[model samples]
Target: MKQFPFFIILLFISSCQYFEKQIPSEKELLQKELKSINWKEVDEFPSVVDCEKVNDKKLRQQCFFEVMAQLIQEKLDIDTLSILYPELDTIEVKVTIFPNSSMKFEPQFSKDSVAYDTIKIDSILQARLVDFPKVNPAIKRGVPVKTQLILPIIIKAKEEKK
Candidate 1:
């Protein structure tokens, strides 16, 4: 009978370790979660009011990109970029959208584009690209995040000579 009681005490002492699990600190848990996340991709792309109604993720992204490109094209059409650089048919623009809904547009030029006046083109783009429709910032893990997109804008289409 005494041995049975001793065995019970030993079992209880050994089982205490199974119940005593070391809880991780909040900071440690947060750091671990952050490490597991892929920072390169966002859950949702930055969008305009028109694209917000889109339910499909891929379609929504496409709508946002299309709208942005169209808006940029329209805005630049009023500028003299085509006249300034007749040979330049396309311009690669780097667009940065902030979490606060503000945006920045920068022209990307190739290394061989030394003949083009990059400063003037950049100034024209900066001056022309403004007052856009309200853009909802990208979402990552349910939080608003800044995102950047590279879009190619057609300066002017060549007319086919008959």
Candidate 2:
């Protein structure tokens, strides 16, 4: 029958749309992927040779921080920061680790810290914080990323004179 053929043709044409894939544009796909990603956290924290062996993610991160703090403490111990500011027992250092595995360190001082000579302290830190161990940059979705952290460094030990 003619009506039967026409109905089949209409059904076939309509069904073709169901099979047709609506391929997304690259930009749309990229935006969708970006939205799904958690920007606040990294897949992997930055690491040094000593921390690479740790299996647990949290432990590895802790190891990296500890190693970094120890290294910084050792480097600054040789400086005369303690003598310059005997009252200053601790200083916060803002460390920025780059994707290229380079690092920068800056002293973080409070706004009310007008009594301390910030410029002199900054210069001393710059002069002292150098020659770090090889550091691997942080990873996010398999890509290396830059990370910033604030580390509290003890400048002077409390002297208990008996």
Candidate 3:
């Protein structure tokens, strides 16, 4: 009986180690992808006046990446809504750019209250509005410049039910 318990413990440990070996760490994956991209810094975007200053170039790059990720997420949400509600009529999606390079995605259904869905996307969108005639040129030192584009998603139903 004692042997049986020991054997079970051994099996569990071995299984865990096997699974751990199979799953790659996030850092490893990110490094691999980063290597593939020919990264180019964006300088055309106007400096963000409100955000706290970043000290290093790497930090700035990371910040821009975060913003881009958020923007992509918002786009995905819009695409998902369109797919999910093909019959939906007059779907209005509100997209806003926050000061900290974030996006708020809110889907408001004017016709049906049940269809309303609010989604907040943060830290994933790069600054859309760049202040020209920059207040702080130093803030733009290493920041990747990106244009902010907002697309209000409105999906209308083809036919209304009487």
Q: Identify the leading candidate in terms of TM-score.
A: 1
In model 1, the clashing pairs are: none
Clashing pairs for predicted structure model 3, backbone only: 42-145, 67-124, 67-125, 67-126, 70-124, 89-157, 90-156, 128-148
lDDT of 2 by residue, 60-87 (tens): 9999989999999888888888877898
Taken over the whole model, the C-alpha lDDT of each candidate is 0.93, 0.91, 0.43
lDDT of 1 at 21: 98
| Candidate 1: stretches off by over 4 Å | 157-162
> How well is each residue in 34-139 modelled by candidate 3, as lDDT tens digits?
8865454334332343333765666654554455344444444433344455654333434444334444444443444554342322121223222222222222
What is the model-wide C-alpha lDDT for candidate 3?
Answer: 0.43
Q: Lowest lDDT 10-mer window, candidate 3? A: 120-129
Candidate achieving the largest lDDT: 1
CA deviation > 4 Å runs, candidate 2: 1-6, 158-162
lDDT of 2: 0.91
Ranking by lDDT: 1, 2, 3
- Per-prediction backbone clash count: 0, 0, 8
